[model samples]
Target: MAKKGHSEEQILRALRQAEGGTRVADICREHGISEATYYIWKKKYSGLGLSELRELRQLREENSKLKHLVADLSLDRHILQEIVQNKAVRPRHRRELGRWTQAVFALSTRRVSGLMMLNRATMNYQSRRDPQHALRTRMRELAASRVRFGYRRLTVMLRREGWKVNAKRIYRLYTEDGLAVRTKVRKKIARRARVPALRATRPNERWSMDFVAARLIDGRWFRVLTVVDQFTRECVLLLADSSLTGQKVASALSQVIAERGAPMSITVDNGIEFASKAMDAWAYQYGVQLNFIRPGRPVENGYIESFNGRLRDECLNVEVFFALIDVRDKLERWRRDYNQVRPHGALSDSAPAVFAAQWTDTAVPGPEPVPDRTGKPAAGNSLEILT
Candidate 1:
């Protein structure tokens, strides 16, 4: 009824007329169209009315304008903002970019740095920092435990436990917080010469012994027979008293053998007590080789000699024994503690007992290479003489 491809409103109006019993041919002719066109319009726009078409057209026009207006407005705002921000920090532009003005004001006086060395220059400024309440508590705990750790060591410890920090930072914090260790710096004593080369890697391979003398409270002299495991630095045997004869020494050694087993070789200084026939017979019976140091050369038997020095410094200097019984008791306690608790730097801070446990026994030579009378290498002579 409507023109070809007619508007939805016109088509709907035509369909309404047809439903009211108007002839399809008459409706088509009234609309300047054909009968087939009227029927097609009726079928397509039977439900849609004139008001719905007007509403949809108005909505589409309004939506299109809204999109175009939003796009133009956004572009204008971005250009204006960029131009304003790019302006110099002059009095006129400062008001528009207030935050930038503040930043310029703060850093304007700072000099341009070309070769600034931080921490060693005038510009090195320290900011006020909040103290770590947790680290202070931990340091106090370590101190109470008598662990004796320095700031660097403490920093390492904290790092091991997942705390992020630097040693110098920790040290500064320590001094400021009064958590630094207040220890008396004793004079650095010269290190003693190292023990002679025994190179005993196996247990019961080489045993070295020496005598250490000390005075009791009554001024009575007492002697300590100190024997050590050369590879381990373990104080295997310690006997107290000067009345110990060669026979007594033998008996004491026999007792040690009964407990810890006999060594393959026993080395000692050429003392009368050790060189006697009684000692020689004991060595033979026990299948232990007896090696004596060169006469007038105490360093040749240095393993036991070094042990004596340590024993005096750690134990003998700590107390005044009133009697042999007191000396014996103290010696026993010291030996156990030394073997189990005291850390040996030579053994990488492990106790002798711990070191011994970790050691894999190997057959070490009898001694280092000893020179012959003509200053030539002695045949199969393992003892070395340091001239």
Candidate 2:
């Protein structure tokens, strides 16, 4: 016989009839059900009224839906935990995680995207842009050659070489290609307020000088005397020797003066070479004022100090010197590159020489001075004082 479907009302009515003194076998026969089915229904619905039976069926349906909801939530929690473990923050990383989730959990893209909080379209996106293999290769070569250069400087260099690229694009490619330069974080010091150094308004108006020391391969120490034009940010002199005395320092200054004319003033720290009588005689002869910073205060001559730090970081620290000649050769080459090729941020991302040339091209000439009645140059009319 085929199985019969019984509603809650019909089953309750049959059970009530059996409970009202009708024989269970007669009820089973009349209902076309076996005696066993009648007993089971009577045991389950014997005391329940129609209202209570309806409530029971409704509760069973609600419980099934609740179980399904809990299962879905658990699966979602599992996927979220996996994502968190992977620490996926970038969209590209999240997209990769979504694919892994789909493959591992046998889930659809829609489900994985929902759980990962990523867009379905983004997860499925494919780039149509060029791979830029040549650009990346060139960038890597530049980075390798100038290991201390950042993406901004590299972008400037690339533009100079005819590449139409922006800093943002280069930075993205820099990170993607792992060409980032690592820098050390210096310790910060808290100090009282200080008087700011005077800014330079014209080339050769002011110059700053400092010394940096490094060791040779044979464990002998040598010193480099660096002189920079404050206005142009140009390295005027980079003299390297085993020992730089006051006479040697004066000679170097004279050499620079012969080439670029004399600066109005020179800023230097209170070192022995700077304070020597030879340096004093040289300054007096040139009529150039020597501005000596206070003892233990290097910030008073901040320009040369900044340049020295860069020289130490980029050139000295990276090179090995076997002899004094070797040191001089390396210093000279680096000084040329620094002045003519390397981009300086203070120069608007232009090389120092390039910026100086541009300034020279745009600068207007001053008016001629009036003649004096004494048939002699007026006092304070000399270029030394006027500068």
Candidate 3:
């Protein structure tokens, strides 16, 4: 019906009239078209409507564009893959590229930069940064004095001294100055699958113990035995001494057990004092299971380890202990507050002592009941005497 190259929608609409029983010759004559063309359209798209024919044409065009885009990407990937093979530019490659740029003086700067895949400004500009000579000198002084300190430690010390510099920048300059910390190679140990230990659902069900060390004001080193309840997160005991053997540790636990009752299980590391015969005998006597963590692994007993870190940070690090009596007094006060005052998130924002007391209160019955009054009319009724 329409001229050639017009939308298929127009032709399909005209053909619909012919399909309604109008003579083909008359339809073609009225629509200014030939019978041969009409027949070609009917053979190809007799069952299709105008919308379907238009959609089919759009899909063909989109498919053609997608194919061309995929081909272009493949060509680009191949070209980049062979770049290294074309030239084995190694040491002094930047210098070589610079010379090539100068040799092509007749060419435009943009054209030469495009060929090299570099920016014109990068090729022309020179850095004006001041080499931090003073900072490097100070870092060397600290590193030399403390041979065991690494770059990260040096960064901390620098911050303490009011120097503002980042670790990345210091590390680059440290390497350029040939200042590297010596590191020890650790031997790899074979590991075996281990059964996971059960978590305690209530206080006294499980307890974790670990040791912490600190120096007194007079530089005398002392150790503290830290025992914590896994369920309540309460510090049950703190034993401090200049020297604590397996027997002494066991003795301390016995006294605490005698007062508060024995735990169902005790979690500990594979330290000599914990794995000794003294501890084993105590465990057997009390009928308490001794759960030992894997060799060289402390995360299995994470509760006591976290508690020990907090003790070191909050008490051991801040106070300067002058005597063993002083240590006892300070640690006892802190432990009391830790259990009764400090709120533990794991215990629903209540203190460990408070949480444990709640369970005990629920378990035990309340005070004696009061006597019941029966066989009486309600209150405020007065009976009349004989008149």
Candidate 4:
């Protein structure tokens, strides 16, 4: 970076233009250099004349040469320290100038060897063995076995195996094997824009309906058909039984319509139950739109999905069902509380019933309460047929 290979004059001129507020992109294109390269030159020659830049290069060259000399001095210091610590001086040196002849000064290798009374070959000896050769092998084995183990973990593993290796050495071998851990790449799911989840502009403008299931004491599974008003977050209806037929669904919807009128459109998934002849007939009869979401995408019907989650978590998960009667009673109580007591965050922390009440005049009349069962069960005896 210090020697960019371009003339100093060219670099200083680019810096001047950059300081004058021209954009970096324009400067890079005009100069045929990368943005990074331009920044590097700009930083080095900022507010300096060409002559000053030349002087700085010369000074840097001198500093590097001085560093080299200091390194040589450090090597000489270590040789003297080793000789005194070992006390390995020959008796010939002791006979002559005592330790002076044994001292290792910064002389030629041959002269230093003669002065210390050691062989010249020993003074010029070099270590050709690579200390990390075994370490690299072990690191490769660990990497092949455990792909997730990074350099730090490999360091700990190596130390436990009685090898004296550090994290820095392992990292060097790790890169030598091209073994950097791969980053997870997120795939973009192929999403074609469907119409957004329809937000109801007003009460009864849109409705989200879905089915949830639970079991009775006899281990008989029952389905709960839930209908929610999207605008007010209101639970308009909950019908639970051993089975819900398409005709029964139509009848329940008819009752809601008779009371509160009909929604502008009903949002549902493409289930067989929602696509039944009875449902289609009912929609045509009441002039209501049946908006079915695409198959396999439940989030399109999120409002009902959220309601179903709360119902299961709070009611079904807690209660032990004894019979259809118990489920019915608990469901009735919970549904009432959900509409009248529980404050919905979407409705400004107001209960769904409270929020709906403000626009009751606009909403169709709600269903009339059915008479209490003091006598025998209704025809078919299933909870779905009762109402």
lDDT for each candidate structure: 0.69, 0.85, 0.75, 0.74
TM-scores, one per candidate: 0.48, 0.70, 0.45, 0.44
**Runs of candidate 3 exceeding 4 Å displacement:** 1-196, 364-387
Per-residue lDDT tens digits of candidate 4, residues 73-112? 6765665566566574444332223234334343565645
Candidate 2: give the clashing pairs: none
List ranges where model 1 is wrong by over 4 Å. Answer: 1-198, 360-387
lDDT of 3 by residue, 47-135 (tens): 88778777866787788889998986675455445444446244234434544545644445565456557567765656587888999
In TM-score terms, which candidate is top?
2
Cand. 2 Cα-lDDT: 0.85
Off by over 4 Å in 2: 1-88, 96-115, 188-192, 367-387
Write the candidate numbers in order of decreasing lDDT.
2, 3, 4, 1
- Residue-level lDDT of model 2, residues 1-387, one tens digit each, is 112477787788788787789988788888888887877776666788889877876787789899999998998888888888999778877887899999988999898888877899988988788989998999999999998999999999999989999999999899988888889888999988978878877777888999999999999999999999998899999999888999999998988777776777899999999999999998877767899999999888889989998999899999999999999999999999999999999989988999988877666645553334423322222322123
- After TM-score superposition, the amount by which residue 271's alpha carbon in candidate 4 deviates from its true location, in angstroms, is 1.3
